[model samples]
Each structure stands twice: as C-alpha cells, then as structure tokens.
Target: GAGVSQTPSNKVTEKGKYVELRCDPISGHTALYWYRQSLGQGPEFLIYFQGTGAADDSGLPNDRFFAVRPEGSVSTLKIQRTERGDSAVYLCASSPEAGGPLFEQYFGPGTRLTVT
Candidate 1:
C-alpha cells in the first residue's frame, strides 16, 4: 500500500481471548511502530522496529502484548488474555527511518479494541 493500512478498524472480543491486529506500512518505510491510545489521551508507543529488529518495546504494557516485523514492511500486534482495560485504539505508524531528526511518523486510523 502507498499509505499505512490497518485491518479490523473495530474489534470486539471476549475478556480473555487472544487477538491480532495487522499493519501494512507505506512502501520503503523502514521504521514501523505500534502505539495504544486510550480515550482522550495521546498515543503511547508500544513497539518500534527498525528494519527487521525491534528498536524499542518499552511501552508494551505487559507480557500479554507483543508485536513483530519479521520482514520489516508488515507488522502485527498480538494480545493475549485480554482484559477490559486493554480496550483502546491500536495505532500503527511508519517513518522513513529509525532515529533522530527525519523520523516524523505517518499514522493509520487505528483498530479500536473493545473487550466485554
């Protein structure tokens, strides 16, 4: 895709189920990131991959959350044993590179996860 694309714009799942959200980033973008945005709050970085390796995964809330970009162009965020508090908009963003200066991100519309 020419721009970032996220699947399942809205997802409703059981409180303990597992789910995976997908992201297809813009062509040639080497930096991919995943963030979570709660209502009325800004996106919080969850993980970032530079090329094929995770540059950072500091913001993943717990072991239940994980992400990967094995090929560097497409990524997925997976959640296990979800809880009601896990409901939020999962955003995917991409930039030209991984670090300093030229890293302005372009965002996807996000997948709204609702657990009941």
Candidate 2:
C-alpha cells in the first residue's frame, strides 16, 4: 500500500488476553504515531516514534500498553492484561520529519479490538 496499513482489522478476545496490533507506514516517512479511539470518540494519541526510538509515549494509559518501531517502518502496539475497557480501534499514522506542512500525519484505517 502507498499509505499506512493496519493488519487484522478486527480482533475479539477475552478480557484478560494479551494482544498485539501491527501497523505499516508509508515508505520513507520518518515519523510514526499510534492512536486509540473508543466508541463515539475521536482518535487519541498513544505514542510517537522518530526513527527506531520512541520520541513520546506519554499517551499510553499505563505499563500495560507498549509500542515499538525497530526499523522505522513497521510498528507494533502491545497490550497486556487487557480489560473490557481496552476495547477500541487502534489507529496508525505517519508523516515526514516534523517541519512545515510535512509535520501533518496521514492516518490508516484502524484495527478494531473487542474485549469480552
């Protein structure tokens, strides 16, 4: 895909199961982001990565959520000991280096997670 892509568009799991959601960003985009959206809400930022390191992770709810972008291309969002409130759509976005209009991100279709 020429734009960002998210795998496993929908996920259903028990309340305490662990899950990993993946995102593939546009080639050559050096900045990537993760966001989560619950029912009837806008996407909320989760993390931002520049190159292979996390530049900002304050959006993560707690230690139960983590993300990594080892090669500056693909990123994985990991959730541990999930609860029913964890159910939401996980979104991935990317942009070029943060300068001028390139700082704006392009978002991918989200991955829907459902915890039962």
What TM-score does each of the candidates earn? 0.95, 0.95
Report residue 34 deviation for candidate 1 (angstroms): 0.6
What's the distance in Å from true for residue 50, model 2?
0.5
Which pairs of residues collide in candidate 2?
A: none
- Candidate 2's TM-score reads 0.95
User: Candidate 1 on 3-110: residue-level lDDT in tens?
Assistant: 899998999999999999999998999999999999999999899899989989999999999898888799999999999999999999999876676679999999
Candidate 1, superposed: residue stretches over 4 Å from native: none
Question: Quick one: how many clashes does candidate 1 have?
Answer: 0
TM-score of 1: 0.95
The whole-model lDDT of each prediction reads 0.93, 0.93
Report clashes for each candidate as comma-separated counts.
Answer: 0, 0
